[model samples]
Target: MKQFTYVITDEAGIHARPAGLLVKEAAKFASSTTIAKGAKKGDLKRIFGVMALGVKKGEEITVTCEGADEDAAAAALEAFFKANL
Candidate 1:
């Protein structure tokens, strides 16, 4: 498993568009991706699950990638977060 923590930079947090894009990105990897804020963790591939967390701007989130493609997945997500979230 690989993990990293990031503070959301967008004012709107992980809203609809970015969340949808995130799910699409997560689905590309063989690894399972999960993001957590506080005690709430959501599958990165599931839009509703991610949105349910209601991640707000400036809140730190921990992202974990696990499985065969964890390294790639983590790297991709890190880039995605920087570009999108």
Candidate 2:
């Protein structure tokens, strides 16, 4: 598994649009992806699951990936968060 942390930079945090984009990006990888805040973790491919986290701007979250494409998944996700929020 690979893990990286990122802070939400957008004012709206991980709202519908970005969350949807994240889900789409995550789906492209064969690796299992998850996002975590505190002790809560959810599948990154599920829009509702990501939105339900209530991530806020400046709040940090950890993304983890496992399976065959874990490294690529982690890099893509990191870049997405960096570019989008």
| Per-residue alpha-carbon lDDT of candidate 1 for residues 65-85, written as tens digits (9 for 90 to 100) | 999999999999999999987
Runs off by more than 4 Å, candidate 2: none
RMSD (Cα, Å) of model 2: 0.5
Runs in model 1 deviating more than 4 A are: none
Model 1, clash count? 0
Provide the overall lDDT of each model, using Cα atoms, as 2-decimal numbers.
Answer: 0.96, 0.96
How high a TM-score does candidate 2 get? Answer: 0.98
> Poorest 10 consecutive residues of model 2 by lDDT?
40-49
Q: Per-residue lDDT for 1-85 in model 2, tens only?
A: 9999998999999999999999999999999999999998889999988988999999999999999999999999999999999
Candidate 1 global lDDT: 0.96
